[model samples]
Target chain A: MAAAQDTGGEAAAGKWYTAAKATYTTLIDTGHAISSAYQLVNVPSGVWIDERGRIVRPSETAAPKNQELKIGGKTINTQGDAYVAALRDWVAKGESSEFVMSDAEYRRRVKERSPREREADACFKLAVALHDRGREDEARQWWLRAQTLSPDNWNYHRQDWSFTSEAGKKWMDKFQKTTTDYYPKLELKEKP
Target chain B: MVNRRLLLFGGATALTGAPQARATVLYGDREVELTTSRVEKGDLWIPFGDLPGINEFSIKPQGACRADICIPLPKELKRKGWLNLSGFARKVKQAVVNDGALWSFGEIPTLRGGFPESRLAPDFAVKDRKGDTVRLTDFRGRKILLLTWASW
Candidate 1:
């Protein structure tokens, strides 16, 4: 299952979907409702749902398998192989997998949404709505509010930044502010 | 002088470029066309139908609620049989963004916190590539690896 959070609607998502030729179920979340529901602050996140519809793992940074890339002459950290291995173990062993987090640990790992963060989501949604309606100036105001309210939600910032040249520069500035460990470390317990 | 037809075309292009107020309310999975109004002080107002009509939250005696969490509303927030959504939002400390035409209410805190205890995943419907609506509930019996990404 896949969800695209682009404000440009299904067409924007379709371009990539068509290119990938993915056989899995793909969906578009033009309003970013999934982000709000799952407490996802970034893209390329994954959630594991069991056959019974219970979440075994909450949203976490998920990268593709065996990716190798260099950015600005520096090697980008790709935990794709490790993540894929853990996922495979879980798939093979289900609930008994050591890769699965205990209920308490899972609850603790999932970040609590603060009032400011919730507000930021609302502001970002409004900005997207406004932008879709062609009220660019008003959308910009709400986008700025969203960014200020939830500085950590890169999706909100990046979505708005893609629309304007001025915002592009700000996105770069914020991106550079991230520490070396931009992706959260995925802690998978070894099987006994 | 340039052709009069060219001059008229340029004027029409500029007219279309100007921003216009849209009358729509987007909440949850619904996009409803609404008749929205602003108070004398510029506060936004929407019908009660539009509130619960689009988003997950409902207006109950305990105030606005979704699942277990409820944010109590004040008396002044309800006026003229319409909800001052912006006012109610402020009372609950939730963000409300209005563009003089469209009003959006932000998320409220969950009951158990942290995405609602990971019980049943909230069901949502979205269009697939072929334009058919695909729902989350459709995959209930199968294990799902829901991955979120973007083209950008």
Candidate 2:
């Protein structure tokens, strides 16, 4: 998924897809709809679904390759190898995969969407609609409202700040001031 | 343009029992205007008759409903052929934002009745990099590693 503002005609996304020689379809999300739909807090998240469309594994930080990045003196946990290995295991073993989360475990891991978060979603989507109609100021207003309602949603903050001229400073300031992992640490292990 | 007017909500109610020609409804990504328009008491009153078109809700014998989920509205709310959309939304815990003539509604909470038990990876449709529409259901027969990424 190309999760960002519906701009640039997704040229960068297209270029990256070509350079990587990727075969999978890359869908563009302008309104952060996928984030809202899947209850994702940030990008590079993944959800594993079975052939029957049931979510075998809930949404979690998904990085395909191991890489450590130093940002605002914090390390983004990219559990690439273990995650990918587990994914491959699922592909090979199907429902018998030890990595596949059981329904009980899935229930425990996935949190229910709060009403405030729902409202935040509304605001975020409204911002997208206004932006589509060339109403930048109104869009910004709703985007800020969305972030305010769901402060933990880094995608809301990151996406909003990325549009401004002082994006780096804004992000660093917020990053340093806040106390939360860029991506929540996932326990990558076989389901017992 | 002579009769078209913009109605905004700012705390106080503004019900004119008026047919607001410019009133627009944005539900999710689609701005659906497939039905007649009416604004009442600072709320976008989606008439009971127009519910199916606006939000897929239909006035059934039990109540206003979509699929099997029904929200039984109060008598006062279902008046003058229009359902008190604000009241109904509040009852359903649907987030609503009225910006001038535009009203944006969030996902109706009723649809997500059961939590993890009903956790089907929602089927979503969006434009592929090639400008063609793609959907998650398109890959139903295969295992999907649905990942969200960005160039940012």
| Predicted complex 2: DockQ | 0.54
For candidate 2, write residues B1-152 as lDDT tens digits.
43333334322233456677766777755677634667666767765676776688898768887887777877767655667887788888899996666778888866765556787887676777767877789888898888887665
DockQ of each candidate, alpha-carbon based: 0.44, 0.54
* Stretches of model 1 off by over 4 angstroms after superposition: A73-75, A165-172, A190-192, B1-23, B36-42, B47-51, B56-74, B91-93, B111-119
**Per-residue lDDT tens digits of candidate 1, residues A42-152?**
888988888887888888778977566564444556578888888898899998888777767776677667878877877888888788779899898888898898888
Could you estimate the TM-score for every candidate?
0.80, 0.89
Local distance difference test scores for all models? 0.72, 0.76
Off by over 4 Å in 2: A1-12, A190-192, B1-15
lDDT of 2 at A8: 34
Q: Say which docking band candidate 2 falls in.
A: medium
| iRMS (Å) per candidate | 1.9, 2.1
